[model samples]
Target: MLASLLAGLGLGFSLIIAIGAQNLFVLRQGVRREHLVAVVAVCATSDAVLILLGVSGIGVVLQAVPWLLVVVRWAGAAFLLGYAVLAARRALSPSGQTLSVGTAASPPIPDAGGTALRTRTTLATTVLTCLALTWLNPHVYLDTVFLLGSVASTHGDGRWAFAVGACLASLVWFTALGFGARYLGRWLDTPRAWRILDALIAVVMVAIAVSLVLPH
Candidate 1:
């Protein structure tokens, strides 16, 4: 039982620790300190839910209907491409406040006695984006649902123990990643740094989106 649990934890971390769309989004939100808690919660919870579904034999059901995955693939690609465009725009023209260590690049409002008004990404918008990043990616299903489930089945009666371990891994990873990036905000204080980050994000998004539609 202990071995199975450890195996699951190992596999879970291995799969999730890779640099992917979801991880990149989490890192960005963490650095910006924008709805960080909600974003982390959504990611962790979604992973848990998907892990549960996989353990419950939903993977088999999904495999039987391959068209479902195809639909998800196209939708995910479109969404990713859309986000890539937005990221590219940000990279090209960074207006308003950006991620900083202790200060934001807020613009002064003329009508408000020259007081700087810090604009932020709304909580609702952040949450929705987090959800889309989590659920829309077909790779998430392939990793968390099909791959994890297939591996967990090998543990026989100790599958639940493995699932528990995997769940814990997700929670721990997201919590650390979301909270830890705050320290790196200082590096992104300059517009050049911000542009570089956004450009990298756009490139990654486009690459992933292209890979999704390409023939395997």
Candidate 2:
């Protein structure tokens, strides 16, 4: 049982550590110190729900729906491409706003003389963004649902235990990432730093989108 739990935990963390839009958004929010806790909660809860669905045989249902995967792949690819373009524009444009980090209890504000845009990192947006990011990309289902579920399903009566382990891993990882990013934000407080990060995120999103579309 311990081994199974460890295996599930390892797999879950390994899979989520990859560079993706969801992680990028979370990191950006952490740096901005804007509703980081809400972001982490949404991410963790969404993963738990997905992991549960996967363990409950929804993975098999998705596998049976071939066209659904195709549609989702295209949609996800488009979304990634669009996001990359937007990131690039932000990086290259001089009109980008600068961000400042604050404590978890207070909201971060824009630099002096800059207009503050209403922060949209509320609980509703967090949940919606997480759901779309996790579900709209069929790759997520492929990984968490199909791959992880297959492994867990093989564990006989221990499958549920493995699922629980996987869920817990997500909870820990997202919590750490969301909070840890705030600590790392100390060095990334400048506008130039943000531009660089945005540029890097653009590159990563474009690269991943291209990889998805290109022939394996």
Candidate 3:
């Protein structure tokens, strides 16, 4: 049991630690102090659902549906490409004003000047964004559910143990990442910092899309 748990933790961490759109979004939200809990919750829950499905033998059924994967692959590629273009546009666009970290020191507040209102908006946006990112990407399903499930299934009686371990790992990682990003956000308060982040995200997204579409 201990071995399985350790293995699951390793697997989960390995799969999620890579830089991706979802992680980038979560990090951004964390930095902005916008719905941090909601962002983490959505990410964690999505992982749970996918991990559960993968452990439950649904992966085999999905394997029989190659066309579905093909469609998803194209859709995911398009989404990534679109996001990349938007990022690049933001980078290139001229701005008359830039926000400085010193200026952002004011405590975050909603348009209504209430913490509650701000929190609500943050939560809603975070959940929705996570859902879209998780569900839209075909690679997520293939990697998390199908691939992981297939590997775990080979363990026979240990499959359940492995799944449990993976789930726990997911919970730990998202919590740490979501909250930890808060510290990083403090350092990235300058407009220049945001611009750099946006540009980097765009590059990463486009590169990943190209890799997916043109795999060797």
Candidate 4:
């Protein structure tokens, strides 16, 4: 049981720590300090739910209906492409507001004239975007559900322990990532920095979308 749990923990981190759409989005939200708790909660909770499903043998059901994944793949691709376009636009033409990390609830967005503007990334929008990024990506299903499930099944009666470890991994990683990005934001205080970040995000989104649409 201990071995299985450790295995799950290791594998979970290995799979999740890579650069991906979900990670990138979380990083962006963290740096912006917009709905940080909500974004982290959504991502961690979603991963826990998916891991549970996979450990419960839902992967079998998923495999039986391969078309479901195909449908999801296309939908994911479309959403990713749309996000890429938006990111590209932000990179090309950024809003005049500059980031101001504050101790208050909602940080003030100060423009060149020092006027405070409401944050553009609202709670509802942030939650929805986080959800879409978590659920729409077919890779999440493949990694957390199918792959992790298959690995867990090998643990026999210890599978539940493995699932628990994997779930913990998701929670830890997201919490750390969501909170840790604020420190990174110090370097991204300038508009040029934001533009560069957005540009990179756009390129990554487009590449992932293209990979989804292309033949395996």
- Candidate 3 Cα deviation (angstroms), residue 202: 1.1
- TM-scores of the candidates are 0.90, 0.85, 0.82, 0.91
Off by over 4 Å in 2: 99-127
Q: Rank the candidates by TM-score, best first.
A: 4, 1, 2, 3
Q: Which candidate do you rate higher for lDDT, 2 or 4? A: 4
- Return the top candidate by lDDT: 4
Candidate 4 lDDT over residue span 50-154, tens digit each: 999999999999999999989989999999999999889878864523542433655577656876643556698889888888898999999999999999999
lDDT string for model 2 (25-115, tens) is 7887777667777878877887888888888889889878878877877787787888788779868766443543334654446445564
For residues 19-135, write the lDDT of model 3, one tens digit per residue. 888888777677666777777888888888898899899988888987887777777778788878877775664540123112233333443333221112335555776777777
Ranking by lDDT: 4, 1, 2, 3
> Cα lDDT of all candidates, in order?
0.86, 0.76, 0.74, 0.88
Q: Which candidate, 1 or 3, has the higher lDDT? A: 1
Q: Considering only N, C-alpha and C atoms within 3 Å, which residue pairs clash in candidate 3? A: none
lDDT of 2: 0.76
lDDT, residue 29, candidate 1: 89
Model 1: how far residue 94 lies from native, Å: 5.8
Least accurate 10 contiguous residues by lDDT in model 3: 96-105
Error of 3 at 67 (Å): 0.9
Candidate 2, 50: how far from true, in Å?
1.8
How many clashing residue pairs are found in candidate 1?
0
lDDT (Cα) of model 3? 0.74
Candidate 1, residues 131-169: lDDT per residue as tens digits? 988898999999999999999999999998899899989
Q: CA lDDT of 103 in candidate 3?
A: 23
Which of candidates 1 and 2 reaches a greater lDDT?
1
Write out the backbone clash pairs for model 1: none
